[model samples]
Target: MTDQTAPTDPAEVTAHLDARLDDDARAWFAESRDRIGDDPAAVRVLFPAVSRRVGRGPLAPGGDGDDPFVWHRDDAGRALLLAAVDPGARPGELRDCYTHGDARERRGVLRSLEVVEVDDEVTAELVDDALRTNDVRLVAAALGPAGVAVLDDDGFAQAVLKAVFVDLDLERIAGIPDRVTPELSRMMADFVHERVAAGRAVPASVWTVIDRHPPADRLAAIEAERDHEDPHRAAAAAAALDARP
Candidate 1:
């Protein structure tokens, strides 16, 4: 996502999104939204055409903070806005949207899972499906608040590790600080060792996970980085050590 400041208000963001659309796109969005109730397959038709109608630029910008739609492209964000207000967007229909979508459409569906009506099993399935992909965008979207709500602890940890594997920043994984486990700590520690053994720089996110769950043995490893050349890594290590009780 680009570095533009995100508009935190949902209503404001929606207004901004609508403002960006030209007359034809706005009319199409309204008509498609109306079609959701009368036509069962409306989303299937409308979802893919979003980019052509809405444009592919970043909808707002910056990463998801208070505003989840911030990171989405205009089309994806527009799709999400449609899904948000549509009462017909049930789990089965949403699942079909994901199943039939291209990566961008799938991302809109995945991020919408948290707000839409979906059972735990379907949520896990969608999240796992996205996690299994090599697409960093899909992987990142999968680990959103919906993933955190539905994934088991083990599954969540593995997803976080997957984000690290795909070079996504740890901050992008929603609620990760509250979700870390000893297993995740160990997994990240092992990753750090492997990178060091291979003469490679560890992914900066590896420290975020490890530092949050600082086991005694892992503290030494984290402490060792306190003097590392990268200021970010050094600060992370020092913060972890300083937090020791």
Candidate 2:
């Protein structure tokens, strides 16, 4: 493994990779990196190592003629390998090293791969993976009003609500309406009820949606449904209902 911290710049890294691999190796590098995610830095580091092991040829003699050095089964292996050696390196950089490294060297490099920061949203998105797999702390770090709306629409409302409860406040919730769909609005109401029931703080801005779309009785019914699962939520629903008068 080349010293990742060898004080090399982007240009130096690119030159090193180009000299070590041929046209076939370069093509595999591009394809593999694209399959993982877009991050040019990752490609720069992966190709040279691959070329070293596979001699710039396809993996099998007469198989699919695919670059056998590249580990297609491990989606994020390239990124993982790079991160193992250089803990402080960015996800993009690590991804580059694996995708551009030599074919023969690719397999051994992949075995060293690890999922160091599962909670990094940028890494998650770049790796073409789901953020829901992240911890609450990671989810909280990744979320904002816009991200929340995206997550909600993608059927990740539960995750979004969890993030909101942990990180968002009234001001943040106030901005949520702009991103809320009718479906998401209802989901948000349910989430708020859950929080209130748990004696967790409720962001007052959520009431804007509750007050605007659904009639009071309808809102009450939604709250009642939530209350069924949690008694404290029932009391909170009752209070919201009484306040409506």
Candidate 3:
């Protein structure tokens, strides 16, 4: 809502929603484009309460749920807001929208992250906030191209770990394979070891960063798992070993 100077691209929203949603659903997106002016505050004011509790599961558009359908509404609202408040649409406003809005609203803000440009610090803060939550949608949104680019290395590591901790899709995150750091690699190695101890399946994708020159002991542990009964664990172990020299 803060004085928006940047132009919001409705196309950005359409690009994400058009192909995925039905034409009936897509029409509203195009319709919502003109619903706002230079000030996007009015719509946010009437959005679902930040404190409202929406139960789990999918929702119909404008329906009584908090999933994708509800998310669509929130996305449309944000797109409209962005359209009206471009030129200076800051991340602080985004953070505020995500914080003050309900589950779907938070998702919408995260969805809008790519289109709305702000300072790196603000991006880091918003991405951190999203990762801190366990909501799969919000986390997915935070890992978008812009979001990942804005994150500091430490913040990036935390986001990656948090994603794994929640068992979300790493495929949704941008700049993964190329962004790995030794610190992140070490953290992933420890996570792998912990999951093994707990008898939980370490997400196979964790190996993307985990295979980076593990210590001798860790390598030995991975080698030991190669013949374990759990084929997945064994495959993961083998993959880890193969990923290295």
Candidate 4:
């Protein structure tokens, strides 16, 4: 919608989206025809349009309610993010877009990884590269949507740990349940210990990772946190008690 050379076929671009979209999303897209456009295949055009039309507050279908994780939802945003991908674009192009692009562009590429063919080493390296950055937005995008499912065990684990390190809202991360592991709990437990010992405030979301049947010590640590002054931390501790091993 924003670009002149928009894709010639919206049908083709949206063909793979059936499973990814729901009834509400379909209706939204239908009404969004003027913004989404009748012709569309490339992500370059769709991305800007979504940004312009969606206005980045809440996600579509749900309009991003009060949930902090809403950034990863909106079907329009998802479709637009995928538009940056040419499908035929090579790894080199994808790499350039990521390495040279601004934050919005980088996010588009990260979101497109699900549909793009990133079999080559360069593209595959992008995931790790983004994870290593302290840029919280990049980290969030890298771990959003298909990322959690696609990243290797260690990569995904690192992403989660990094989110905590950067003080990112864990809800922004998709597939947190599947990605959680005992080793991650240990890492988080260690982090919580260090932070608490230093008189630094620990994010309550850390308990989200630790709540998944963590070891006894970790469970005890979270349970003790139930008395924390911050309602978020106290709430996390309370919830973890029921879910803990």
TM-score of each: 0.78, 0.35, 0.69, 0.60
- What is the TM-score (0 to 1) of candidate 4? 0.60
Instruction: Kindly report which residue stretches of model 1 are placed more than 4 angstroms away from their true locations once superposed.
Output: 1-13, 61-70, 75-78, 81-89, 219-245
Per-residue accuracy of model 4 over 76-178 as CA lDDT, tens digit each: 2444444434445545556765676666566656755644456546545776787888877677666655566667767677888888888888745776765
Position 10, candidate 4: lDDT: 32
lDDT of 3: 0.60
Per-model lDDT: 0.67, 0.42, 0.60, 0.57
The positional error of residue 123 in candidate 3, measured at the CA in angstroms, is 2.0
Instruction: Give lDDT: candidate 2, residue 125.
Output: 50
**Cα distance off (Å), candidate 1, residue 159:** 0.4
Model 2, 126-163: lDDT tens digits are 22222343333233223332233334344444544554
User: Native-vs-model 4 lDDT?
Assistant: 0.57
lDDT score, candidate 4, position 130? 79
Residue-level lDDT of model 1, residues 1-245, one tens digit each, is 22243333445556757766888888877777777756656677777787787777666543453343345555345445545445544666778878888988877767666445567888888888999998887787777676677888888888888887778877657776778888888888777655553445655666678878766676566567777887767765565445434
Whole-structure CA lDDT of model 1: 0.67
Give lDDT: candidate 1, residue 24. Answer: 86
Query: After superposition, which runs of candidate 3 have C-alpha atoms over 4 Å from their true positions?
Result: 1-12, 15-32, 46-77, 89-92, 212-217, 225-245
